[model samples]
Target: MPAPVPTPAPVPRQRDTSPAEGGPGTGSLYGQASLTLLVIEDDPAGGLTVPEILDVDGHRIRLRSARNLTEATRLLTPDVNCVLLDLALPHGATGSGSGSGSSDPVDPLAALRQVLRIAPRHAVLVLTSEEDAERAAEAVRVGAQDFLFRDELDGRLLSRAIRYAVERKRADIAQYKLAESKLRAQENARLERGLLPHPLLEGSDLRFAARYRPGRSRALLGGDFYDTVRTPDGTVHAMIGDVCGHGPDEAALGVELRIAWRALTLAGLCGDDLLATLQEVLEVERPNEEIFATLCTVDIAPDGRRAGLCLAGHPAPLISRPGRPARLLPYEDSGPALGLLPRARWPRRQVELGGSWSLMLYTDGLIEGRIGKGKERLGQDGMVEMINRHLDSGLSGEGLLEASVTEARRLNGGELTDDVAVVLLSRSEA
Candidate 1:
């Protein structure tokens, strides 16, 4: 049907002011658009088969009329948020595109898709002849928020259905976002546990203090891991390692490596042999070859002051003597990171500490923190300086680890954007 001859200077209708959508005022006047609506129909006369309806805020709607999909597309605007589309039209017909004038009859579903295309951002209500639940469901599935039958649709009922359709769409969107958040958290937790362990300190007198913080903000963990275990001989062995990447696969591989390290250490493996076997585990567990782990291991002697130190593609340990500044342990004979060099030899370096000295093992996360916004990183030397300042205040064990993490974050001026795992071992005159 041709559009009614345009009323030259037709008064732009006042928008419906209903209590529901919070328009200009309460719907005291007729023709107010509190529930401003547009009806797309085939009839030339402006009439709605809908009997009774209410908008979201319990306001009657001021209905606008559009004959067929052609006028409907032109009238679609933000002011008319809800659309009541007639589903009797034929297929593949919207008003736009070449040869899409009144001559081409449009399919109902295709017309819905086109009307949705035209008013892509609006909520839609589909109207069918009979109460066909299946067809109504399809309309809702095809993006119409609700469906109404021409026979049962009254002013009150139509109003309620339209309001419900708008609310349902908002609820669906919220639920999707919440589910996405939960899935992300679950994945992060799995990776984090692999990178940090509760430490097996059953038979040793040494106190173990460690802290791990992932570099990825809002992420559970990255690829850094640490473990501590005591041998039957009363010796305490501790290590901190970091794989090359910050992904879940790298983290899972890191967890496997740590577990293997603990088992081998309990079975009398140490230094090169333990690391060598770990490379085999890596080859089997890693998703690809590009991933590798840097490690720092320290074995405190039965008496505690003496220790065997090994660095495998990792930073050297830091030693802080009682009443003296802390400094890096010797890195004279360090090897490349595990999983990189098949024949790598991580030679053990033995060091003696006077009673009351402290040994700290940490991943590169601590030393690699950026000093400022620039590329300046707080390298090992900078870390040593920062530690000395913290030690001057006489902190130890968990207290010591907390102070170190705080200082690292403070120096970075925010949370360190890398996974940090630090383990500290101290011996007092016993």
Candidate 2:
């Protein structure tokens, strides 16, 4: 009689690794939770035998088996961390292809592609015989984390490969998100640069320099806006304004007001008439009734020796002469800010801008910064003194503006918390 065949050892039952039961395994790859493996193969005769696997911390890895794509779909849950797919499985009766637009019945990797599409977030590993090394490599290129040969797979190797594949998938996702964020930031910078004004001072004798800083963190534009343009008649028009808030919506409103001011000024509207129409725009376009905007307008004559000044609840422009200290132009007749008073009137005052002089117009952000740790602010008087000091040191033009803004930030102890916009127009008798 033939010797009796030794009885095969029964497979061990998988333990529950749910979070409720003190959570999953603390394996090397798994940060906190244990790992689960879903094996997809149509092997009724048990051709493929998976050995009992353990994580790095010696915790047993739970296993689930699926006979076909239909059964695999039902078992693909959020708790399933990794998938082990057999490459030799049939494509089933439906003959579904990779979501790559066409279906091919003869394609051996069709089932693997289907598994990838259905379980995109989970890590996947393909199993093939040792002879099919080319196909295994192709599977990895097609999106699988890795591939293993059935004859070479052991408990230790499978456990390590599963952990590596999961970590790699996570790294890939993080890299993708970082690239996406950088692209979005680049697009936003381009848009903000386009929105900034391009001073139209062609055929003008004056030299113009400006500096703008937004208070909002990581923002390129804010509620402060300014524009300078030389009209058809040789008179150069310059205006600067600030909306009540420093948000995106306020920035948009400032842009609209700047464009509208440019159009109205080119059309010959000045002083009260232009400000009245702008108030109308603010009332209609503002998100609420409480929004308001302060403005300052200056129109330099063709001779560059005189200018018309208007103030709508705005700071007075500082004027500096060849041998004199900088001082603010008269602002006693200033009117209410736009959207604050219905039918408000802004008065135009004729000021003699002597030959060879510089005029600096700015929003309130520059002067409102705290002087030190105390509550006292760098008011208009302090800013005038600062400008005089810079001028005494021979700083002028762009260098002067740069030094001024830099000093303001330094005095505030850090970055200024409000948007600051400064425009400097200068002329020297030649």
Candidate 3:
């Protein structure tokens, strides 16, 4: 008998399978569904005469060969996904067809760096001898996706390594993005704390408004800062400080000192004693010898009739009573800025705030603004006139501050390059 005719079973429908969905990773590894490789070798014999590579789907691969990095660079394209670079470059690896030893010992890592610059998003595999594993590892750090020992590698192993390396590189890019986002959040938080402080006035019938803008563009906070607190005598204590530099560290130190000031003021620390303790804090936290801070403090009387002012190498507070024009308190008797003069003594001078007065405390970033088109700054007198003009404009609260800053920027014809911080304390006699 000729054998029974075989009956065919019902055919099963095939499911759609894109190369990217065939495995792990972003699917990009298998998207091309190909094993195109640029094999760089300066060896006289060319590539491993018997070329072999396991593809993305567990299949063998035939490599396209290049004698040097120059040819390899020329061959690099979107379709050529991976590179197999040989560390033992022979003569003329510089695209001259000479070889590795033909001239200078061609550094494979240097070649790898060039490859990365050209093909930043491509995956690469570096081939090295067992004794050169260290150099191979370094190649990975320099942008190669993976490094392998030439002796132990096989077709299947090479394919798996390529897939893993590609996946890892993509993961690295994602992690970097996440880290960048987190850093931005941290910076904003520090800025919020440094620029805005918790108000200490509750029952006091005083109007307090403050505005702060860092010299650093797109920055939330800077070393220039201010704060206020109500002391035990029902006196409102206000202060403004400026660190020498503009950086996150300086802003952080300023915040620390501001918070410490509030705490000490509430605890009855004032004048030289308070400044001395703050200097100690600066001494401990400042990053280096060049780091320092300038400060000014004011303690208003309970009746709003008098105020004790202290200056520490910082611009003095500008005072404007109802009948008088704005003017800076005093600076001739001021001590050196904190961190500049050890055990510095800030003199406590009595100033008449009188009834219904407005006191403006600020960092040098304010007075140091430009004057007209000249390189000359606003200085102490210029700032007083500017404030007087704003006060006469009937702008108050945040509006007053915004107007002042706008004028400064307008005078400068751009944003203030240095950090600017200001606090306004206006009181009515009891």
Residue 277, candidate 2: Cα error in Å is 1.6
Considering only N, C-alpha and C atoms within 3 Å, which residue pairs clash in candidate 2? Answer: 24-34, 25-34
TM for every model, in the order presented, reads: 0.65, 0.82, 0.60
- Candidate 3: TM-score? 0.60
Ten consecutive residues with minimal summed lDDT in candidate 1? Answer: 2-11
Query: Which sequence of candidate numbers ranks them by lDDT, best first?
Result: 2, 3, 1
Cα deviation in Å at residue 80, candidate 2?
A: 6.3
Deviation in Å, model 3, residue 38 alpha carbon? 7.3
lDDT of 2 by residue, 1-430 (tens): 1111133222333345443231221234555445788787655235345557888778777787777776778776667778888887765622233433113456767778888888887789998888889999999999999999877777899999988888787787778889998998999888877988999999999999999999999887999999999999999999999999989899999999999999999999988999999999889999888899999999999999999999999999999999999999998888899999888889899999988999999999999999889998999999999999999999999999999999999999999999999999999997
Root-mean-square deviation of every model = 9.4, 5.2, 14.5
What Cα-based lDDT does every candidate model obtain?
0.74, 0.84, 0.74
Q: After superposition, how far is residue 213 of candidate 1 from its true place, in Å?
A: 1.9
Residue-level lDDT tens digits of model 1 in 23-115 = 212132224446556777665242354433456556666677676677676666545657778775433334444444333454336667777
CA deviation > 4 Å runs, candidate 1: 1-160, 172-195
**Candidate 3: stretches off by over 4 Å:** 1-195
How many pairs in model 3 have backbone atoms within 3 A of each other, for residues 3 or more apart or on separate chains, i.e. clashes?
Answer: 13
Model 2 earns a TM-score of 0.82
